[model samples]
Target: MRLALAALVLLLAGPTPSQFAPAQAPAQLRRGLASAEAAIRAAACDAERRFGEGDPDANASRCEGVRGPPGVEVGRTSARLRNPRNAPPGWAKAYLAQTDGKKASEVEPAVFDLGDRVGLLRPIEIRKRCLSCHADRAEVAESTRAWLEAAYPRDQSFGYALGDLRGFWWAEAAK
Candidate 1:
C-alpha cells in the first residue's frame, strides 16, 4: 500500500526542472539579446524620427540625469542582464578592452563567461544614431555633453571601427 501511494505521489508530482532541461544557452541568450537589441534599435529609430520631425521633446532628457549614458536604453538593459550579481552565477563581462587606441568598438562584442555552467553570449552592434548618443567624450552634444564629460572623463568609448563589438547581452538560464 505504501509503495503504491509513493508511486501515486511521484506520478502526480510531474517532471522537475532537472528532468527536462534546456539545450544550449545560446538560443535563450540570443532571444534575450535580440529583445534588448530590438528595444535599443527601436529607441534609436524613434529618436531619429522624432528629431527629424522637429519634435523638440525628442532632445528632452531621456539620456540625461546622473547614472550614465541612458540614450541606449536597450543597450543598458543588455548590460544589466549580463552583470555578475544580478545575473546567474554563470555570468559574463562583455566589452571591447581597448585594442590599440581604438577603444571598445575596435574589437566588436567580446564576452567573458565567468562560469562554464549555464549561459551563452550574444553581441549587438551599435548603429549610427546609437553612436551619436554613445560616442566618446567629444562627440556628444552640448546639452548632455557636460554630464558625459563629468561622468566618463576618460571616456574611450567613441570613434568605433566597423564590425566592432558594440556590446553584448548575456542570456543565462537553467542548464
Candidate 2:
C-alpha cells in the first residue's frame, strides 16, 4: 500500500530530475550557444554584404552591444588585422589554432569555460568571393583601397587562399 501511495505521489508530482542528471544546465548551454552562433553569423553576413556593396569598413563596431540570450555573451574576431579588436584574449588563441588549417571545422560545441560559463568557437573560412577586398592584387575600387589603406595601415589579413581560416566567432554562456 505504501509503495502504491508513493508511486501515486511521484506520478502526481510530475517528472522529477534524476539525481545523476544535471538540472537544465546542458539544455540551457546548448540553447545559448546556438542562439549566439546565429546572432554572430547573421551579423557577419550583413556586414559582408554591406562591405561588398561598397561600404569598406569593419562591422565590429556595429555588432557591439548586441547581446545574446540572458547569460550568453557573443562576439567575433579574426586572426588578422581587419577587425581592429581582433586580439585573442585568454584561450581564444588556442581555440583558433585548433580550427586553423581545416577546411571543414568540426566544432566541439560548448567546450570552453569562462569562470562558471561555457563557450562556443566557430571557425571562419575564406570564400572565393571574399577575394575582392582581401586579395593582395585584386582589382578593388580605388576609393575602397585608399580607405582600407588609411583605415588599417598595416593590414595583414589579405592575400589568403580560399579555405583559409580567416578567424572564428567566440561566444560564452553561463553554466
- Candidate 1 residue runs with Cα over 4 Å from true position: 1-117, 152-154, 161-163
Per-candidate local distance difference test: 0.41, 0.59
Candidate 2 global lDDT: 0.59
TM-score of 1: 0.37
Clashing pairs in 1: 108-164, 108-165, 109-165
Model 2: per-residue Cα lDDT over 1-175, one tens digit each = 9999979966775543221112233554555556556666565666575654455445556564554455556676666657576766555655555655555334433345344555666666677777677766456668777888888887767766667667776666555
Pairs with backbone N, CA or C atoms under 3 Å apart (clashes), candidate 2 = none
- For all predicted structures, in order, the TM-scores are 0.37, 0.59
Q: Where does candidate 2 stray beyond 4 Å? A: 1-28, 48-71, 101-110, 137-143
Q: What are the clash counts of all predictions, listed in order?
A: 3, 0
lDDT, residue 175, model 1: 20
Candidates' RMSD to native: 15.3, 15.6
